[model samples]
Target chain A: MARTVIYERVALIGLGLIAGSMGLRMKRDGLAGEVVGTARSAKTRDMAVGLGLCDRVTDTAAEAVQDADLVVLCVPVGAMEDVAREIGPHLKPGATVSDVGSVKRAVAEAIGPHLPDGVDFIPAHPLAGTEHSGPESGFPELFDNRWCLLTPVTDSPDAVERLTRFWRAMGSNVETMDADHHDLVLAVTSHAPHLIAYTMVGVADDLRRVTDSEVIKYSAAGFRDFTRIAASDPVMWRDVFLNNKDATLEILGRFTEELFSLQRAIRKGDGEMLHEYFTRTRAIRRGVIEAGQDTDKPDFGRGTKP
Target chain B: MARTVIYERVALIGLGLIAGSMGLRMKRDGLAGEVVGTARSAKTRDMAVGLGLCDRVTDTAAEAVQDADLVVLCVPVGAMEDVAREIGPHLKPGATVSDVGSVKRAVAEAIGPHLPDGVDFIPAHPLAGTEHSGPESGFPELFDNRWCLLTPVTDSPDAVERLTRFWRAMGSNVETMDADHHDLVLAVTSHAPHLIAYTMVGVADDLRRVTDSEVIKYSAAGFRDFTRIAASDPVMWRDVFLNNKDATLEILGRFTEELFSLQRAIRKGDGEMLHEYFTRTRAIRRGVIEAGQDTDKPDFGRGTKP
Candidate 1:
């Protein structure tokens, strides 16, 4: 199937995994005539060009967005405002400005007022990524079958529709959600879970009794999954925790409360309660598999072959 | 490699994933002759026979162990003592008795006294499994390149050596550790981590705002991995927690303490602290990959292709 060119020029600010993959995917699908990208670091910009992640690697955000019909802010949550400000005046009058930030409400609030009147501020989060970052870490198929959530605070319906088409053309499932609701859902899904994984890994690290070699050697039993998630980009995750504080805290509170109940069950040797709790959680895993969100193969489809 | 047959008339006293896999692999490797199995549920025993998981499916533990050279207790941790007691009188002289239980110290304590004299009690835990269980879920390759830790509390060196060779022939790397230390190492590596995964999945389930469908759909971000670990067999996990209470709780206490600090950091908007913590945890993930315990491929090597 062929995709229409939704944008004459697409500019990606911050050539990391998300933006880099977006560029490659957009180019591969013929969704953009030209993909211009800029990174804060010169090394990243050079690498982006070397990897052919963009049609053109510009020196600055302003240069990249000069004639771009679609400008994506792919920087961390903390840098969204600065990138928006830098590219605001250079954005085409009828351009649709979106972001790939994980936290929607904070990204919208930070970059909302910075955009000019004629442009649209559609805060979006592509619910897809790998632990690896930078331009070389991305591939054209990264977003295929993954959801890209759009939280458009702008009143322009046409802009949202066009941007939704752009994402779909790039091999993503587009869904519109409210900014606050998106944050809460993401807090439930991504932010809080990452924090818990990080916490568990940290606890294992701090345990003096279990040597690091043992933790790493025997990780395949269960702890290895936590390590895979905890290996995500540190700066981006830190910003996510800082920006999505309230919702993350709320989810954590619920998590700790439930954990305490299970802990008490273990202490009192209440096998039935633990059994019931574990049984119920298994249903959600089945749901994920049925929804096609994950593979049903054992161990997340990891091979057992040597 | 053609593995040497280490035992004749081996009895597996539960037709679950571990025992079923062991039976299949032993047959594949030519490591056992006449692999017999028995399950408390007639349905499971029938299924094991139907799947050709064993040479014979006996009705009772006593019947299965008669004239057996090796008997493995593959039931849940809570049932170890009773199963041992039931099979004690029927065991052949100088038979090697071992278990595939997750927690070592507790299994030793429960089944040690029940074993008849002249039998060796060598508790072993194979750090390999999938989310699926039961007689039909066994695969001959499931233990390939995985760790199998043995905690031999008995004084029979020859018996321990024979059991180690048996596990190695089943396609696992064998290592020996003290039972108590084994519990503590696994507490950090497996038990606490599973509890946390279960807690997070339960919290996602309990949330009224985030519907179950949305969670299942967007689980790939992080929660999907938790769901995978949390989807383990309920009865087995329940017994693990109840039997390994002290060590799991100790790890959980340290876990909550670290979680509290991270929560405080998030509350204070301490991005630096979060970044530092996440960065340190990445080293452990790298170690896991380097040790061949897990793959370094993005998203646990899950494909991005649609």
Candidate 2:
């Protein structure tokens, strides 16, 4: 099938995993006529160009966004405001400005005021990533069968629909949601779970009785999964918690309450309570598998042998 | 290579994932001359026989263990004593009796007194499993390259050596550790993590504002991993916590302490603290991947296109 070119020119303002993946997928499928990428670090820019992640690399975000019909801020949430300020004057008129930040509300608040009058600011977050970052860590298939959510800050159906079509061309299912609700939902799904994983791994690291080698060797039992989650980019997650503070903290408070109850049940030997709680959670796993959001294969179909 | 037969007859007392995997692997490699299995549920016994998990299915534990050179109690930790009592007299005089329980100390205490004078009791735990459980869920490759820790309670080096050979023949690296220490190590590696996962999933389920369907859909973010851990067999996990009370509670206490500190960092907007903690956890993940306990590929190399 012949692919439709959604944008004549697309600019990615940070050459990290998310932006690199978007550039690769767009180039692979001919979804964009020309992809221009920029990064604060010169090494990342050179790597992105060398890897063919974009058609060209620029030294500044302002240069990358010039004359681009679509501009995406792919930097960390904490850096969104500065990038927005730097490229605000260079953006093309009537261009759609979006982002791939984990926290939508904060990103919008930071970038909303800096944009020019005719540009549409549509905040988007593609629910796709690996435990890796940087320009070299992306693949064209990263967004395949994943979700990309858009929270449009302006009343521009044309731009929203166009961006939606672009994400679908890259093999992502697109949905639009309220920015506050997006942050809250993400808090429940991503932010709080990451913090908990980091905490568990840290606790294991600090324990005096169990050596680090033992923890690593015997991790197949359960802890290995947490280690994977905790291995995600440290700066990205730190900014995520700091930007989406209220929602993440709210979800963490609720998590602590629930954990305390389960801990009490363990102390009291309330086998019934534990059994019921565990049984109830299985339904959610089934839901996730049925939704095609995750693999149901045993051990995520990981290789059994080393 | 021609396979070596470690035991003339091996009896499995429960037709669950571990025992079924053992039977299938033994049958595939000819590790045992005859494999017999018995389960409390007649349906499970029939399925084990139909799936060829064992050479034969018996109606009772005593019948399964009759003249068996090795008898393995694969039931829950809470039911170890009862199963041991039922099969004690039927076990061969020179037979080795072992278990594949998660909590070793409690299992050793439960089954130690029930065994006859001549029978050797050695508690073992194979740190290998998927979220799924049951006769049909077992696969021959489940224990390949996985750690199987042995906490032997008997003085018979011959019996210990023979059992170790049996596990090795089935593709496991075997190690011996003190039962109490094994329990504590497992608490750090598996028990506490499992509980934390369960608590987080439960909290997500109970949040009314975030609908269950939404949680399931957006689960790819990070919560999906926890759901897989939370989906494990409820009865088995219940018994694990109830049996390994002290170690699990101690680990949970430490986990809570670390969680609270991270929570405070988030509340105080202490990005440095969060970054350092997260960065520290990444080293453990590298250790796990380097030790060959987990895959370093992105997302366990799960299929991207569903």
Candidate 3:
């Protein structure tokens, strides 16, 4: 997993779920020569220091990225550009800067112009997470059995290989795709689904006739699933929707059309149509389980056992 | 658990998730003198036999209930009336008859009328299950943290007490409620949530561009939860929806109205409204986890040992 000890120092600006996992894994596998992390909140810096998630914790992005050979931004999508600008002057010459945002194209557009000429901007998106947020919520095994899609701005083979090795050491299977393709795939697989969950949870919340007690008691059935999604960090999801608006809206449009059709099946008492639609989705669930995207045992999101 | 040994023989008339779990617990705790089970399908009978979920798996409803001191009908709400008609003559005088239906009032109305006058009709609904059905889906722990509400029309205190003991032995906390109330509570919490999941999954299934591969690939975002619910045994859910139509329709009407309001929020770019609603639902999720109705873990249907 040392992967040739590529980077001298890896800077992580914003130690939330993804960065925290990266820090823990870097420590566990010695993937980084030195791990430097920073957070806006003093509380988070203290926690990162106490957890030994990094070799250094700093108040500003400049301090975190100074002299680092690789810099990975793990902040909310909305904050990427600002963080990039803050670290632009301090970044090492010929350093590779990447991110773990849900939307890659927007990230590249937002952060690409800020990096110095010699520094490389290689945007990456890791398709993994739990609803929990902040440093303490992350575990070393969070990236295990998950996909880490790299959307490189420039075809820097050396940069790509180095970053790939870094993520591989962190326990993620790596894939390279274009920025827009990454966004489109995410819009279908993650963005639209999250929006729908947020929508459903909002809907259930509006149902005042059903007391909170009743909804809580019977969540085991299905509503709990939506809650799990809606419970996702608000700023992260909000940024994803806003940044990936076009693709998300496209998927949502398709989703609404399909929903209306199903609505008709229910209204028409067409059990056959309903059953047929339901039967088709099972194959997708099976495919996911077989593809190792999901597990047969119910995932409670307590962090997978090592 | 021998708490008066309510019945010498407890005959479970359907060896599926609920009934199989009941048989497992009763045998595990020695709550009944003997545990018997019945299934219409020979394949199911064989599976139940292989699982050792019952001492005997009879094919006939009449033969299954004969000489049984306690008779539990664990079948679809749609089949309860016909099953009652089929097993009425075989029930011993003064023996108790209970069921594990989602809509208890309708079950009481449909099945209670068909029971013999001497047979005590005590309708019960267990608030527990996995998306999986059939005898193989059950485990002794399925009912460990769930509630089993009994709706008894009979004024026989002794009969109600006896059934309570049986459920306690099955690892359930029993709550005695009227049939109509049980239907209303479940409609809000369980049935409506299920319908929404089914509807969402159906919506995803109809999305032509979001290939099945993509859905499976990015299922962790949120869609997978609905897939699990929508993947549930269709016939059982079909029966649930058809039998509990009034309650289902009522809750669904409320849900649709709420959903429309949220859609308007999204369409109008009402971020405050969206944030406010999303924030409130988090409280309900907290309550559900505290109630132990759901695990606080993220991605419930995704992986093992998380």
Candidate 4:
């Protein structure tokens, strides 16, 4: 049986939305003994302190993890390895190291080699967020009931269980899977959908005859939904795209092929094909509702055209 | 000056979400002297009567419109002309016939010739609806703070003004514009957005590599928003697609060209292009929020994802 433990000292190596939320949650729940956070900029460190995101804030990654029992690398996926290396020598022996990056496979490979043998390296993703980002954008309830999936290496039961229990203590249901599986699942569920929304917004913006003002003015019927998702943090998403290149590209390839077929049907005025396609798509939405992932209501949180 | 003449023995044709909502609003505000509604099916007519959607309900359009001062056509855009043709001879002289169809030009053009010379025809779109359909789905607050656009061609100013007042009484902002303009605006804001959402869902469904279970799960990031929009009344949307073909196609043409360019940039691994396009789209969402068209808060009505 795994022993129950509250982290004596936790170091969060980023000060953005996810890290801020996790900090707030840890503080509110008293899940960690001491919460220390670091950012690349002194300005960010100051803001994190002002926001009370952690008990201590600093600019140096090594200093933040110097005496920490748990070190979480919540920076961008591309920066995970660099952060890991910077803090590698400073992390206490037998310390638990994890991340909150969206892409799992690359991050696992990138940061895995940087960790000392005594330190644990686990990759995790909290499937919770808003379109907004940064320390100010996060709320305490951001991860209250969301799924937190961990993609850990083989023969890592003890470290995986410890992280799982930690997330559960922070109000998340935990699941463990391989990094590639996590990447593929997220590509379909998160990455492809965001890309599609971003692409659609790009498409609307390209409308020469249809003025952008008109699009903005009348975004009620459906496009507003696309805009909400497209408005998500650019840097986070850009990093996500670049890091999860293989999985995203694979899903995107499939998407484009299907989209081409749809385009042909529309071009040929094949209403039957169009109708059938729409009908099939409708069932998937019902499944989403059934899976408790979506609401049947219009606009989700948005009220009707008022 | 606009007259205060109420619709005497008003006929509400094709009782569904819009017509039922109108009925409830009329009852709450006493907008009409009398309301007699008809439905194609006996069951729907009975539901309208049972829901108190009208003062009276009838199976036949002729019976419903008999001696009515105003007839509001609430059928789907595809069924508008047929309903108009069927009810044309029965409409009394000086009676104004209007509709709440989303598509304006074709609906107006199709129903215009069928009306008697002295009978007025106005095409109106009350920019409103929930995903739920049928008379039971309506409530008095449906039109509250909503927009009701009137596209009239040489109709009696007195009659148009009275209709405008009726919608105002139902708690809507009234605007008068040409049918073409209304269609063009809706095409950008509503029609193309719905189409793209439908297309995205279709793409997801066709992807053999992306399992349905995974798509349904982990959707909170963005895909869930598209699903909600995609869950709108399929038949109503089908009719909308048919009626507003030209403007939708034109906007779609522009959308496709833009999407192709974005796809090319993505394939070339150009992060700047991706970020620039995404960054620009955010301003429109801000504009929408400023316009009070959307809420900045996450649809809290949805509550925390469980």
Candidate 5:
């Protein structure tokens, strides 16, 4: 199965789920001639080499991106700047540098100034992940049919197109948006929802009357989904909230207002209002299914889609 | 394929997911000699008969419960009293009466006094359902490996045991608790989570800056699960919030307090506190999986579980 290679060499600055998955998929698709990777954790670096996710496991970010044509920063949002500073002078001339961070504006603000002028800087985010993280949690099919948004702060059409092709070859649908809009969209779609899930799980944990055992045993009653969302990598989510503070807080404020309205309706026995609100939300779920973003089958088509 | 029958006649007073599943399972298992069902909506009654989910379909609640050895009121919580009043005099002496409302204490209060002295009243809730509703939305395996909780206020051990056997035959594990405890437990597990989900989805819907198309298209980023839970039957959830007001409000208050603390942590750039809070909740998700309440497979095990 021969295919056109998108890049001569690819360097991943972090060997976590997204980067590991990128390595596996690129290798499977023969998208790059050589793949080099590194991580701050020796365990992760060792696991990447052992799993054969990359052709070369480098000792430092500077060494990894030395001659790579496509370098991706896959570290937590908070660590992006330091990594960019370390690797800036070592980046190959005319090479494209991108990232898979959740918050775009913050990533641009943190890493943009550290990149060298000759290197093309384009930030991206793949709106795809499981709760699991680290090098061991990746799979080749993690990005199949998933959206990958490119929020390029630099005006480099050729570089952006090249990065888009790489993601498309790895089974992702690519869309480009500005940094600020991407962050706001994500705050609504991912950040606020994750915070709400985390808070709900925390409240359930803190309730003394509802024993931990009871909550765990009866989680199938809709609480289990919240638990699953809240179980995501803590460091990634922490950086997301810290970086996208304004959008997250704004969305949360709106959430609180909506919640209070529903609470008042419940207290006043306003069944009509409650019913209307609940019924309207159902239409959005249908739209998601129709848009090919999610499956409409019962239980998320679990137990059958594979 | 002969098996010992649990009851001669079982009557389901509503034809929604729970009752529809119960009727289908009973017929498939041959646990009841005849299953009778009726719904307030003519369309639902017609669909129940068309699907052959029950052996007989009645036009009225009184007719449905005429000689039923077991009468299960599967109506919304607010309608329990009216259904009980209409069916009370017609229930056969020695019949075991029950309901499948999420709010057990309110259900017991609404339907208890209307029951005849000779009839045993036990309120039960089968903690199993898909987002779909109506008679056609049910299947025989809906209750498989799920829990059916019975909260009986009566002192009839024999009747309780009989009802337990009935649910077990339908592939549900049974547990008995006092009504108030059941209400509180459900408030924590089901009601509050649902209200929060509905609120989050509503907030997304109301955000003018984020187009509905964008929200629907990018829902896989954790918002889709909330929409799935919020897509549940509106009438049923409205009744749940109204009937279980005290416990639901108490849990909501706790959820708001926890959310505000996390919001402050985000605003103050306190990643340490955020990470600690997020990491602790992952353990509960593990507990849920270990308890066999949910699967740990990525994406809710949507593709491989079947």
Candidate 6:
């Protein structure tokens, strides 16, 4: 099928998993007439170009954003401000500035001040990823069927609509919401769960009685899922927790309280309470499946191999 | 591809996921001359027979085990004692009786006293399952490449050897360990992680600020994994926690301590500490993958669909 070009020139800064995937999808679907990508490390840029993730590679964010109609900052949440400052003067007038950060409020705060007056600053977050990272780890289908949340920071209806179309062309369902609400919703859905998973894996590692090998060998019972969540990019996650501190901490506080109550139930042998709580959680799983956010097949349809 | 018959007649005391899977595997491979299954619920018994999980279905455990060479209890850990007393009088002399309960030590204690002196009672647990349960959920390949831990409370080497071969024929790697050690190991790898998942999902559900629809729609961002773990059979998990209280409580205490430390780091904006903790946990994920306990493919190799 022939594709329509959404943007004449699109510049992607910090080519990692998210950016590389965007580059692949945009170039494959002709969503952008020209795609230029850059990263701090020379090796990553080389790899992105070798993998056909971009039409060209640049050594600097400033060099990449020149004359581009759309510039997306795809770096860690902590690095957003630095990239924004570097590329602010280089951005073309009336260009739409956006990002794929996990935390929308923080990204908006970081990039909103650096944009030129005519630039349309729209912050976005794609709620899709794998545990893998790096330019080589990306694929064109990463955004297919997933959500791309847009929190428009500027009064640019035309720019927001165009970006929505661009994301839809890249195979994402687009939705717009307030940046602060987005952060809080994400804290409940993503941030707290990741911290909890990391903590559980860390606890398993620190336990002297259970040897690491034993924990590894018998993980399928449940611990392996926590490990998979914990294996996500460390720098990315650290920046997330730091940048979105208030919301994540709030969710963690609620989680701790709930955990303690369940622990008390276990201590008291309150089977009814435990059973009720577990039964309640199953409905959420069904909702997720019904929402088409996950597969209903057992074990995520993982292949059974000995 | 001929399979040697390990038992002349095998009795399964409950027709749930584990029992049904065992029956399907044994019948398909000709590992047993006949597979007889019994369940308290008539609907479950009918479903098991309709699914061909057993050659025959019995209404009572006593009738199912009569003259059987092998009898395996596949009930909740809390119900082990009553089932043991029910079938104790009918168990054939020299029969090897085992169980598929998650908590080994408690199950051994629940079952050992009721068995006849001539009967060899061995408690076993397969570290394999999916979120779904019941008779209809069973499949022949459910135990393929899974670990089955046996905590033998008997002195008969011949019985233990035969049971070991029986599990191997059903496509599981069998290991024998002390019941206490098995309980502690499982507390770290399964019990504690499950409780943590349950708590996170409960927190998400209770946060009225984030509506249920939003939580379900955006769950792909780490929260969905917790929901899957939390969706497991509630009665089974409640029994596991109640029966394995001490070890699970111990693990939960450690988890709480580690979580607080990380939470403090987040509150203090200690990026270095958070980065170090997250990076350390990545090694465990690699270990789990190398140990073959889980798939290394991204997102457990889930299919991308809208």
Candidate 1 residues lying further than 4 Å off, grouped into runs, are A208-212, A299-306, B209-212, B298-306
DockQ of candidate model 6: 0.65
| lDDT value, candidate 3, whole model | 0.77
lDDT of 2 by residue, A96-195 (tens): 9999999999899999999989999999999988887897888888888888999999898999999999999878899999999999999998999999
Name model 2 segments beyond 4 Å from true.
Answer: A208-212, A299-306, B208-212, B298-306
| lDDT digits (tens) for residues A52-161 of candidate 4 | 87998876999999889889998988788899889888878888888999999889888888878788777899988776778877666677667898887636688778
Across B187-216, the per-residue lDDT of candidate 2 in tens digits comes to 989999999999999999988455647887
How do these models rank on lDDT, best leading?
A: 2, 6, 5, 1, 4, 3
Grade the docking of candidate 5: medium
Judged by DockQ cut-offs, the docking class of candidate 4 is acceptable
Worst 10 residues of 2 chain A by lDDT: A297-306
Q: Record all residue pairs in model 5 with backbone atoms less than 3 Å apart, i.e. clashing.
A: A302-B302, A303-B305, A303-B306, A306-B303
Candidate 5, DockQ to 2 decimals? 0.66
Error of 3 at B40 (Å): 1.1
What's the lDDT for all of these models?
0.86, 0.89, 0.77, 0.78, 0.87, 0.88
For chain B alone, what TM-score does every candidate structure achieve against the true structure? 0.95, 0.96, 0.93, 0.93, 0.96, 0.96
What's model 5's overall lDDT?
Answer: 0.87
Candidate 3 docks with a DockQ of 0.48
DockQ of each: 0.63, 0.64, 0.48, 0.49, 0.66, 0.65
* Tens digit per residue, CA lDDT, model 5, A1-306: 568799999999999989988998888888999999999878889999887889989889999998999999999999999999999989888999999999999899899999888888899999888877888888888888888999887688998899999999888899998888888888988999999999998888887454647877776657888999999999999999999999999999999988999999989989999999999988877877887777766445322113
Per model, state how many residue pairs clash: 0, 0, 4, 1, 4, 0
User: Model 1 compared with the native: what TM-score?
Assistant: 0.97
Higher-ranked by TM-score: 2 or 4: 2
Chain A fold similarity by TM-score, each prediction:
0.96, 0.96, 0.96, 0.92, 0.96, 0.96
Which window of ten consecutive residues has the lowest lDDT sum in model 6 chain B?
Answer: B297-306
Residue pairs with backbone overlap in model 2: none
Per-residue alpha-carbon lDDT of model 3 for B1-306, expressed as tens digits? Answer: 344555899899888888887777677776778788888999998888788878887888898898898899999877899999999878899899999888887789898778888888899988778767788777777777678889998889999998987787777778897777777767766777777666656555555364546556655557666667677777677677666667777776665566556556556666677667667766667766787766665535321221
Those runs of model 5 whose alpha carbons end farther than 4 Å from true positions after fitting are: A208-212, A299-306, B208-212, B299-306
Q: Write model 1 residue lDDT over B1-306, tens digit each, in one string.
A: 766779988999999988988888888778888899999899999898887879888889999999999999999999999998898888888998999999998899999888888888889999888888887888887787888999997798899899988888887899999998899889999999999999999999988355546877777667888888999999999999998999999999999999999999999988889999999998888888988887776435321211
In candidate 3, how many Å is residue B271 off? 3.5
Q: What would you estimate as the lDDT of candidate 6? A: 0.88
- After TM-score superposition, the amount by which residue A288's alpha carbon in candidate 3 deviates from its true location, in angstroms, is 1.0
Pick the winner on DockQ between candidates 1 and 3: 1
